[model samples]
Target: MTFTLAIVGRPNVGKSTLFNRLVGKRLALVDDQPGVTRDLREGEARLGPLRFTVIDTAGLEEATDESLQGRMRKLTERAVEMADACLFLIDARAGVLPTDEVFADILRRKNAHVILAANKSEGRAAEAGLIEAWGLGLGEPLALSAEHGEGMAELAAVLTPIAEEMAERAARVAAEAPETDVSVSDEDDDEAVRKPTRARPLQVAVVGRPNAGKSTLINKLIGEERLLTGPEAGITRDSISLAFDWGDVPTRIFDTAGMRKKAKVQEKLEKLSVADGLRAVKFAEVVIVLLDAAIPFEQQDLRIADLAEREGRAVVVAVNKWDAERHKQEKLSELREAFERLLPQLRGAPLVTISAKTGKGLDRLHAAVMRAHETWNARVSTARLNRWLEGMVSAHPPPAPGGRRIRLRYMTQVKTRPPGFVVMCSHPDKLPESYSRYLINGLRDDFDMPGTPIRLHMRSQAEKNPYKDKKNWGAPSRLRKHLDKPKPKKG
Candidate 1:
């Protein structure tokens, strides 16, 4: 098992800055404003020779009630419980506040290993705060500037022993575990051969409008309160990804910030958050467009699903909060009708009803996701595709433009994963967009690839004029001379 480290501190104490440095990427959004990070963000961190998983938690707050701040505090405390070690950070410039002292004491009682650090300790102004950090009494306070990359060597040195200790503990646990009998029949061996050598984690991103239960659904899927979820509309600011096993399938799921209309996204932080979520969608192989059942298939929801379709990603529409719905069958039928009418481009896509709070309909959601993925990656043999194309063209022949007949000669699938195809034809430029849509729809229906994006490209493959470059190519020499002589006599 890899060592786990949690960086916990008050807001704007440069916790995100240090996280970015250690991870060697600007993953977590950093701003001068406090509470820029509300959800817990995890990344693989590396410092010199040490490598481990590091979690950037929400800024520790003193709130104990059910408000947003209180919810954030509870999430951070959960991180402290799960981590192998905690790095208690304080702003050296501001010295130690009462909140810092209170959190430090809580860490001492809860966590066995705690390392205190005074950030922004690069200058003389932070000297007093560094001394104050030591008074917290967790341990010797390491003075470092997260932004300036100072004290990284000292931090790495301190973490080396902790890594070794974790490795030792893991070894002991492995040694004490029971071993299975090593017996393989011929059938077992053949079954093993049929299995894949390795399966990479599937990349899935859940996105929707604000207050659509995106975060809550993800938390339910992972079976943990990993993401900060409450009655708040925009509790998630960063697109946090969590790697876990979803019913025996390894998956990396992204919980993205709720996307709103472009005109309404006025704040700088919100803009960044939305952009981050968009990036996640681009990288994802499958996207689940979450919808609030009460106001399902709104303009924003349709736009989101269409965006996923345009990106050539597998899409599954999930109506969340179904447990609260009053009329189930009528709502389902209405939703289906609206889905087909408003978003015909994604016709035949899976529409599932789910309740993130009650964990109902998740199995169906999982099956739909897997089915969509399979369809997205489906490939058609070139011979089969050509046969189907011939039948389609025979059934509805190409239209003639300007009294000249257009020919459809050949067709083949060019790629998969949101399958692409190329058709060899006469006057590709003259092909109408409606005709192209006709072919795409045919492919989706005949090939059983419903709802996945299909790309069709027309290419003119007419052979070059064979005799254009040759001399005396038009007629025989004698015939050419006779024609020239006749012309002179007539004059």
Candidate 2:
């Protein structure tokens, strides 16, 4: 609920650099490359005593409808509408271009409160270019250098008053708000709140390799050109989150940058983009790892699926560009084989084939996502788990190491949201990895938790009886002491 300020301008004009400076972190990927940011990324920004929300948007570009740049422009305009103020940046070193002049008017028409800044105004050489920026008719431009940290005090002076006003309003509203009390049930897990919320939107992140139609899929879902899509690869550089409803379920979906192999990812900017996509996976409740149907289950795709599994996220494999495939049956077979063969760790995950461009098979994908989410949050009672454990162990006895039988005494469900269980046994270390997999697979099948990650830990303990671990197995008790007093030896 903080005050929001958005950085707006053409590409490669130090907008992201300034955003990073204000946020005090390298949250956005910054490089000399133009059009690196295709979506708006939000962060909590701080400059001196001023604190507010900051958004970094894609550059303003003019293009026809259905084109990528045009879509990016539309998204940026949406950001302008949401922000309290806009910092319109012009590159002083490059001087004002025609696009800058055009966008200056656009910002004026689009937003009421716009602050103009001439960035890269660090050295004397930029003075002439800085002077030229004033001709755009956005009042006198604030001379600033985003990279060199100059003119920040001036920027702070202008923002501090605004920040203070926002703070006072927020405090007043909070003070007037009423408080409510609610009871938390003891039967439910304490971390139930951490699981996916029913009232809130379902957070789903669609991520995959470059040009796999991630943006296209999101655009199809929203029935608008909400994201930029093109034949070009690596168009999406930020994990853009959009909110909408699928059926009755409100959903928040993230279209992330395509993940390439670590060897192919060399640029500092791309590395940051990949990291941002990875972060989206961690935050998401259900992650749809999109794949190119024409060439599905590539090495990178396997790695992405593995990463999601390692994070314990509910996974759905979505093969995009399905309409482009020539051999439908053969391709489907190939996808299935490759998915199960390459990513065995994510066995039984939903493999949904869809054409993001044509909007084909989306319903199936939606169903799969919903199913995976339900399974991820699924829980089983301790009595049920213990009963199932006994049946499983009786069917396939655990390995007897060194003639000592590894007795699995009992098991209980420890948690849900990727259902975790702990099994009490003798010599837990002696339990084989294969047996652990067997138990996990059984849990998945018996509990109807397909595609959801399961955690099982074997903990060692002695027999539950109080005298089981006690010494004196051959010694007589007090009640039998009189009868056993050397009578056997005398006979």
Candidate 3:
């Protein structure tokens, strides 16, 4: 691993701007708003010849209790502990606030290697604040203009030495390490390392209507207030991904902004946030369509679930705030009925109940997600598919058009990952939608595919031509008959 640097500061002090500058991309959402970044976002930072891993953390607030800002502070402190060095940025324009001083003392107590930097130091207007930053007792502040691309060379100059030292240490460790071989074949071991099974973290996105506690659920699952949450709706604007293990299963969960109905989402920012949430759903293999236990399935919720189904993502419907429900059994049953009736496409998919605030029923949700992923990627041998197809056709024959049934001649699995199938037939188009649904249901039941989208493609046999194999196309019928008769004369 490269040397890790953590940029810590109070809210809106250009921490994210510097992060974006170092990473050479606008990864962290930046605005004039304070505390825009409430989670620790890491990026591979490259400046000049120096390269290292940099973490942009939430603003170091003075809240040391169970409040939101306190939790945010705790997250930032955790970053400080994990990183090799800390870049303590103070807004030179608004230099050296009490919170910054308090945060500085905390860093000192933690014994973290600290690099003092004063951001927004562009002109004489900031000179007084920049000078004041020197008294923060960390070191001579590296004057920085993160937004305007100024003081970057000086900042790089300071970090280059540390980067070089880290590289040397890493090289030495690698050189000293002994080479060993596993008992298993290299290819098999490699496959075990990188495949979707358990090796790689499962990408799961939690999406739902605004105020459905999606962010709260993710935060509860991670066991840290890693995301910003409030009583207000749509607290999360950006789709933030956090990595953690769920019951020994590595997982990456994205806490997305709650989606409102498109008609109601008139603000440009809301549209972007909703778009980002949609993107997270598409990027994810498994999406947890969260619903408020009290409100249950709204029209917007149905739309979101349908979108996930259309995207061919494995789905789990989670009713959040289950602890607040008065009649648990009845609510669960009601939720089930509604889920099936409203989102028929995701019927038989896991509909779990949980309180993201209290972290209930997460294990069941976890299991369901894993199962859905497996179902989504399920495959069947062509022989087995054909066998199943024969039984299905026998059970309910395709609709006969003009007193002739549209024969399903054969079936084969074209691919997996949402389980696509191809059926060769006499007349594919003659197969009705209801019949196709029947076949799909049969496939689902016979193959035990649950809560996963299934694809079916139909190909009709080529029409036969009477003269397709003829040798002499120009020959008249009389000449052809005469030629056949001459063959009898020769005999």
RMSD of 3: 4.9
Q: How many backbone clashes does every candidate have? A: 0, 0, 0
Kindly list the per-residue Cα lDDT of model 2 for residues 219-333, writing each as its tens digit. 8998877676788899888888877887777788998999999999999888989999999999998999999877788889888988998888999999888888888998888
After aligning candidate 2 to the native by TM-score, how far in Å is the CA of 30 from where it should be?
1.4
What would the per-residue lDDT of candidate 3 be over residues 1-491, giving only the tens digit for each residue? Answer: 47999999888999989999999987777777687777678788998877798999998887888776877788888889888888999988886788878878888877457889989999888899888887889888898999998988888888877777778888999899997644664456532443454446789999998889987888788887667677767667778778898877788888888898888999766777788788888899899999988788888989999999999888998888899999898878887887778887776898888878878898888888888988887878889888888888888778889887788888888877678999999878877888888888888887899779998989988778888898655589878766666454563
Write down the TM-score of every candidate.
Answer: 0.93, 0.80, 0.83
Q: How large is the C-alpha RMSD of every model relative to the true structure?
A: 3.5, 5.7, 4.9
**Model-by-model lDDT, in order?**
0.91, 0.86, 0.83
Instruction: Tell me which of candidates 1 and 3 scores higher on lDDT.
Output: 1
Ranking by TM-score: 1, 3, 2
Q: Which stretches in model 3 have alpha-carbon errors above 4 Å?
A: 46-52, 61-71, 92-106, 120-132, 143-145, 148-154, 160-183, 187-199, 230-232, 402-405, 460-478, 481-491
Q: List the residue pairs that clash in candidate 1.
A: none
Q: Scored by Cα lDDT, where does model 2 land?
A: 0.86
TM-score of 2: 0.80
Model 1, span 385-468: residue lDDT tens? 889988999999888888777788888887776889999999999888889999999998998988888889999999899889
